[model samples]
Target: MDATTMADAILAALGGAGNVRGVTHCATRVRVDPAESARVDVTALARIPGVLAAQVVGDRVQIVVGPGRVEAVSGAVRRGAGSATAPAHRGRLSARTVGVLVDVFTPLLPAFVAGGLLTALHNVLAGPGVFGDTAVIDTLTWLRGPVALVGLVGAAVFALLPVLLGFSAAGRFGGSPYLGAAMGAALVAAPGLTADSALPAIHLTPETGWVIAGVDVLAIDYQGTVVPIIAICFVLARLERFFARRTSGSARLLLVPLLTLLTTGLLAFLVLGPALRFLGDAAAQGMEWLYTGAGVLGGALVGAVYSPLVVTGLHQGLIAIELGLLSTGGSFIFPIAAAANVAQAAASLAVWLCARRGTRLRALAATATAPAALGIAEPAMFGVTLRLRVPFLIAVGATAVSAALLAAWRVEAVTLGAAGLLGFASIAPGSVGPFLACLAVSMLLSFGGTLAWARWRRRRGRPIDGEDPRRSGDETAILSPVAGRRVAVESLADQAFAASALGPTAAVAPESGLITAPVAGTVSAVAATAHAYGITTDGGTEVLVHIGIDTVRLNGDGFRPLVRAGDRVAAGDPLARADLDAIVAAELDPVVLTIVTEAGARTFAPIDGETRVVAGTPVLGPVGSPENI
Candidate 1:
């Protein structure tokens, strides 16, 4: 896409260009500063042709587009955002998005591992110079091209490291995403470290654990590995915030940059460098044990909790496992985790296909399916499957079963690219069949189980609570939009009520035929005829509910009441009965009118007339408007 189109597309993927205040990109991802951090649209970004996935790390919005496309995406973001200053609005990275990022991006981590391995391989093969002589020994050396290519391709993942984690971390902290990537790049520069360093080193003094070359190891390649760079960026973001708040003069702007660099640079030496090695080793070992011991069970457990982990913003901790495992040769956690992801997708897709939902719901399911299938389970877990109980179980069952199979068959993945069919290519040729079988079992079992459970619930005319009741709290309790009818006070239609305005509104029916209430409290005056009442729920804002609009001409002719003035009612409460046929005969629309009577209640918008609403349910809000009642 052209710069403008790309910028617009990326911004829209992050929720909207209007939400993005600033933008930057690196080799593989774009960083964004959205108006509201929670507003980032993970699915949309994942669906973008050039974009692989999206992550919110810290305060930045990171859009992964791969290495080559980073420059274009970043350029587009900068051009689109213009030169706007950071807004006061701040948001934290969502755990679900984080899961998506870790799953999607980490799968590719093997590429980095492969590159290092390949580079090592090249040194091993080229040492004898057999290719030049075509001797018997050189025959084996003929494979050098392929090996080098593999390693190069793998190394390329790290070449663009600044873009990947930079954007990912930025999204977490809610800062300038591109800036984070840029900062990461700076740590890997020539002057930053010696030639042989693997990552940046932290030192208390020159006498500390000796350097690789003249420069401190901390100033070296902080690429591919996790933790150190992330820590550095995190510290920098906080320091930036502190400076922004404390300094005010023109020199304040200069000081912000200066202090940020000094503080982060020092932190890199004192902490990030040393801490990463320890963290990476721990993550690596933990994943190794989980994979070896639990095998498929481990994967299933991880999959089941993966979505929740994303919500809690702790998924980042898992990255250490992948890094550590790759460095050590292999990790069971990484492979099984990939399998679990596929199981989740299978379960989600089964629900989407078997359940008869509306277009919107179907679309959401469809959108989440592909990514989940590809081993990116966040969208599926958060948007589609975890919304209910059965789907979650389906995902867990599939993952566990498949993971078990993989462990039993001793399937080994040699590369990475997510957990779906495409990712399967990474498995060693010897293990491919077993891995495939495991995946098949996972998908079939999970999908079939979810579908059967959903159907059974439908036949019984009862709702399946799904995986967890607490998580799916009162989803069925939304108010009905029916204008008239005296249904049971508490039917399956009414779900649990909460404590907020949007929570629950409980009231009894005044009349029998059809009950409606002046749901809000802002309303002060009813029509002159008293056919309806006014309500104000928006703290001080008010709204006027003139039942049937012009029906005010009826002058309470055909209405009856239940509870009178000073009574509190909730959604679905029976307020007053209205003769619908009479109103229709009077040429008035029977549809209940929810007029935006409050002037300041801009945040409250109608949720499409098609939605079923119940009486006393608070739909629109911000009471006490001067123009209302």
Candidate 2:
């Protein structure tokens, strides 16, 4: 699908643009903070043509559109959301602060996480007894410098976090980002002073410093600390903007910097600095109390809420607590987090099992669950479990049990990669066995629970989230082969699909790479280019599904045809997975044409334009025919 179409579909799935409080994107997912998380339709979102998955973290909606496309996708979504949505009604001061915090921190997670992981690695390599009783530069002395360089590179990112956060905060706060960077650099350079004479016991001496307001200045280093740095930058940016509007060019530049620094410095030293530090420390203390006093119950609570925190972007804030945990002892959060992810993935897999065979729902669920097991749970979480609600609760319930067990057994990871399979190796040296056991137990519980729930729903004749609609044996329905926006074939710029040469054709702007079988019939022909499929319907209608314009020239570059000629398949069966990005990159229109190729089919069933649908919804066939039944 075109970026605009995908954007439209995404916004619609997110309960229209009005539900969005804030929207942003990283490499793979377009993250949106929804005004009402309940309104979001995750099942519909997963079936959107190009959407790889959808997840809700806290109140945020993360639509995974795959790599390299989110920049355009997010831009489109932002434009549409901005135009359609009203100003956000921020209810509380804390909620407003959190929104700003998420905005400032969301863009920097990759760098921040990389630094944390590197720090953990450094601890593993250089902490006690590495040479095991051999003192002076023994076995691996030659590797010392290179390993030190590895630590240095990672440390550089940590040390300079203040500058990055400052820049992001300024941009978000509507000020010149470079000014924010300069202010941050100043904070780093002025590393706070101590007063020895007035507060004599600590052996620190007072020095001449610029006292802003009544407070004496001591510039403490802001390395690896974001909350304080962002606060300072927010104030600095506003100050700069306030100055900029009142002054002109050259004087504006110089005076703005001078005044901003002076005022913000004073505020930092007198207020925001101490306040943010206290908040950080208090947060650490609270987390400490929770872990120490609450024990297994604390672990249960953390596991239950962790994924929600991740989605809301609040989990990024807890990163500080994780770092603190590392500094104090081992981190217990990682195991619980792993359990939550693994259990959710298991729940999604169970949903796939309960889905009817040979349906688009089954194919998508199967495709979405694997990434979760590998630690990318957004797809399975948003695309499957949480999308259905029941599975999500089941997964969370299983997580509490597993996390409680983890707490009792004292499982911890020395590092921060909390993905399901990969996280196993990150456990603190001897805790791997218990960790795996908890994981196994959690997965089985969630999986068994999901299956039981799905069957119960079926027995009661309740609408199963993944169930296919019942169809008659002689039904002649032409369901949509791809999830996307419907466009009349006549509206094509090239008009090739609608030419007099071709009969009864329609076009779809597909948002997904996967193309499904549109009719229950035999595969009449699979085009050599793999850009088209010919299927003869069970009612003797031969249909041609041509993927895109000029797609044949790409010579099957990113197209994976999953079925072969003469294969008997039901409607919603997987036919192929087309790389929509590759098609766009090659400068081809990713419009799919579904034509009734039989000799004298004069007309198709009535279909409307501007319609968005999943892969199995009715698009063409006997619905409009005289002998429709």
Candidate 3:
């Protein structure tokens, strides 16, 4: 597909460039940070030609196209967006915060991932088995050089994180990026300051160890720190802007950097550093305590909210908590995440099956559902479940259940990887069985539950579509096709058939799979799925025999036709053999609608709900009959 056109569609679907705050592309996705992420048309983007999947992740609308093409798409979007800026629309405060967070950290993620991968790879290759204990790796002298080299490469990226953060944060805050980077580098380059080193403390707490109440908060090194550096940059940006407005010319530039750095550096070192560290540590500790103390309840809670976190992009902040947990032992986050992600994926799969054949939604769902099996659930969640509303909630409930089960088994992940099927590799070897079981149960529950709920909803009888519900003063009758139990048209799930807009109708729940002619007529139309058939009666009445709701999506599977369109058939002649079990397996509603297309009719119901009924049953009495009412 042409990247330019695709980019145009992407931008359009994102509510135009005026709605966009930032536009960037990751390796495999085009990320459009929007002022109100909710306004971006995720389903529309998914339907756009060449788009793999589209979702709003946090405050950004992310479109997943493949790798090489994403760059082209990003460039096209930039050129297309031109000078437009995001409008000052008052959106949800939390979403706006998440958007800002996404903007700040998205650019720096490659470096973070590089650092993480290097650490994980070294642990696997030299220190121990990828998923097992390894102390012997420490004694392998030959491996030390290579492992150290890899570790250094990885650590080098993370070691200067503050500098990069300063640059990005400065630019975001409208200050000079270079100057901000210089100030950030200064925190590290300061003489006698070492990364993660303890500061000279006045006193230490016996319970929590270091307490700001007694000790200096800035005593620890700032190397590889996130929250503190962010705080420092926040202060530095305001200082830089303050100095810029008061000074003039080259002198302004000179003094702005000097005085801004001086004031902010002092503030950071003395105030922001200490305060942020304490807060960050407290938050991390709180997470640890909750996961340990509450166990299954904690897992269920986490599982329930984690997807929402992912949606808002707040999940990125969990990197610190996850790393902290991983370093100490195993992380409980991954297993829970697997349940949430896969359940969402399963929900999407259910939607896919329920969509009609060759529909754009079905095609989009195919692309959307594929990546979710590997832990990429944004497409499925945003494009499918979240769009539908009900499916996502079902997925959430299933996620909670699955995660609770994982917690019951005390499952934990030793390392981080894809959080769907591939995540099994990350689970501790001893917990693999439980993890797999959790995944299977969650998927089945999510998929089956969605289908059942959706079918039930459809059957609950929504308002009539198009035509009026009232019958004419005079009425006609329509015959029932193959049936076990005859039900009223109003009792049918499909509003169109239920309202008898075409005329009166009857719903039949088939006992045998056999579909038979309701009245002697020429076969007019037979759906490709073979689930629907139309016939014109000898009396010139147009009768439609539609079997199952959304079963047409099955595309003729499990349906065997005895006769085709244009064939003459008598009442009770075999029409088709449907696989009822397959229909249920596919999560389709099996109720059949037999409607009169032209002549007015009224329905008659069997006194018993499950009474035996069959083809040619006069579900609708003839026009003007007392039974017609």
Question: Could you say which candidate leads in lDDT?
Answer: 2
Deviation in angstroms for 526 in model 3?
51
Candidate 3: residue 238 lDDT (0-100): 78
The better candidate by lDDT, 1 or 3, is 3
Worst 10 residues of 1 by lDDT: 494-503
Tell me how many clashing residue pairs each candidate has: 62, 13, 4
On the 0 to 100 scale, the lDDT of residue 583 in model 3 is 93
Candidate 1 lDDT, 1-629, residue by residue in tens = 65567678777766666777776443234667678887787777767766655667557776755433555567667656653332222112342334334433433333333443444344334333223433222566667677667556644555556446665675566555655676767655534333335554532443344444343554334555445666666677777766766687887867877777777666665566556655545544554566666755655555455444433324445665666656766545555666666777777777677544443335556766765665556556655565553587677766766766766676665544455655555566667677777778878888888878867865653223211221121121123323333222234121211111221122222222464444323224333233544444424433334344345345455555433333333333444666767777876544444333333424333232323334544344322322122
- The whole-model lDDT of each prediction reads 0.52, 0.68, 0.66
Number of the candidate with higher lDDT, 2 or 3: 2
Model 2 weakest 10-residue run by lDDT? 83-92
Q: Which residue runs does candidate 2 get wrong by more than 4 Å?
A: 1-139, 187-189, 192-221, 302-402, 410-432, 435-629
Q: Can you write out model 3's per-residue Cα lDDT over 1-629, one digit (the tens) per residue?
A: 79889878888888897777777654345667787776788889889987766766446676766433666787678767762332232334553444444445546655544564565455455544334544335666677788879878866665676787778877766677887788778665543332224643433332333333554433445665555666677677878766876788999967988898888877776677766666555644554576678988876876777776655434545677888789988988888888888898888888787664654445545655655655656556655676555687888999888988988898998988767776777889789889999999889999998888756644543110101122212223455677677666677654434555445567788887888766666677665456767777655666677778656457667787766555555566677888999999997878877765545243333222236676656665554554444
TM-score of 1: 0.43
lDDT score at residue 368, model 3, on the 0-100 scale: 59
